[model samples]
Target: MKTTVEQSLRAYLDDKTANGELGPGSRLPTERALVAQLDAPRSAVRRALDTLEGEGVVTRHVGRGTFLTESARAGAEAAPPDTSPVEIMQVRLVIEPPVAMLAARLATQADLDRIVECLQAGGASSTFEDFEAWDAKLHRAIAHAAHNGLLLSMFDVMNTARTLPVWGTLKRRTSTPERRGCYHQEHEAIVGALVDRDPEKAERTMRVHLEHVADNLLGRV
Candidate 1:
């Protein structure tokens, strides 16, 4: 059975995830912070962190801060042999809109900075591979700003699926410079909404963006 301190700490983290306060790869508060915030003993905080480490939900470095782990992400991205690119997009459609909404509600300045960096990089990319990489980074940054580990892990899976040869083939055929420019505009719109902290706008923009991408892939819009 878990101690009260451990249980309380877990509940706190869960609540943070729900509220977008603790995104994937984001560092956890220091033991001093945890002790103060949770009103628990230092030993209790240490033990709770230790328990999370054992569960693979977090990792601790000697000097660096504790961080959410990629264990779940690795498992989520283990694509099945028969998985299709369309299926991956289907999953993305289901997950990404909500992530945008949460990010709009909770993104910090740091998160926005990282996202903007990716956006700039994407725009400056001279090659398809480079653009796609920055695109992935931008999307991942948004998901991270959502502060939901599970959702980010799910995104990792879908993102990995996009790297499949089939996806590469299809995108290569359809991704004209014109289309890439359109995607950049859509990404800008989504980021604008996030910066405004407008959850409804963020959610709607993200949905429309994904829909456009899907239609493009299917040669519909």
Candidate 2:
């Protein structure tokens, strides 16, 4: 699992223990169960368990499943490092606009198709979870469209940050029909610039979109 994903799972598990949902010696959820429950990949769950075991937060037994160690239950109240929404937005502002520019210049037809597909799917979503998944896909497609390996890797890191539980909590609280509608328009504008092969317009539109999202998340603009 990526470091960000591990941290996210660790934070969530710590919360569960702190809330008295799982006591010392209690068996943790199966890897498959954690994957489904956290909407995470199997690799992430496995890695998180590995990290927990290393931290003395969990114990893995062959064929018996993983269990929370006694120390974990007692130490679970300690919070993980903070990742504020503002900081996330600041990072996006630095990286994504240029990515949009490069993507506009470089995107293949297939990349455009995939990005459009994600947009359409998101627009059709009836629930926030479904919408959020498509939203992430859309951004990822754009990042891939940039066609730079390093940029793609950096974008993956940002995307991982988005997977933090706090990100979801803030998104769910801030998302509304009006904001969603605005986002749809903003997304379309960004894609429209890309379809036109207008790098400058694409970059500008993407930055605007990111700023709009930040504002919505912060209850500003």
- Estimate, for each residue in 1-221, the C-alpha lDDT of model 2 and write its tens digit: 45466677777777887698878788888888888878888976775665455344666678999987655544344323376777778888899999999999999998899889878987887777667766777777788799887776566555555655788799999888777878888889999999999999999999999988988898432
RMSD of 2: 11.1
User: Candidate 1, which segments miss by more than 4 Å at Cα?
Assistant: 1-69, 219-221
lDDT of the candidates, in the order given: 0.78, 0.77
Provide the clashing-pair count of each candidate structure: 1, 0
Q: What does candidate 1's lDDT look like per residue over 47-136, in tens digits?
A: 667545533456667799899765433632376646776786788889999999999999999999988887888888777766776787
Number of the top candidate by lDDT?
1
Error of 1 at 132 (Å): 0.4
Which residue pairs in model 2 clash with each other? none
For residue 163, model 2's alpha carbon misses the true position, in angstroms, by 1.3
- RMSD, every candidate, angstroms: 13.0, 11.1
Report the error of model 1 at residue 34, Å: 38
CA lDDT, candidate 1, residue 9: 78
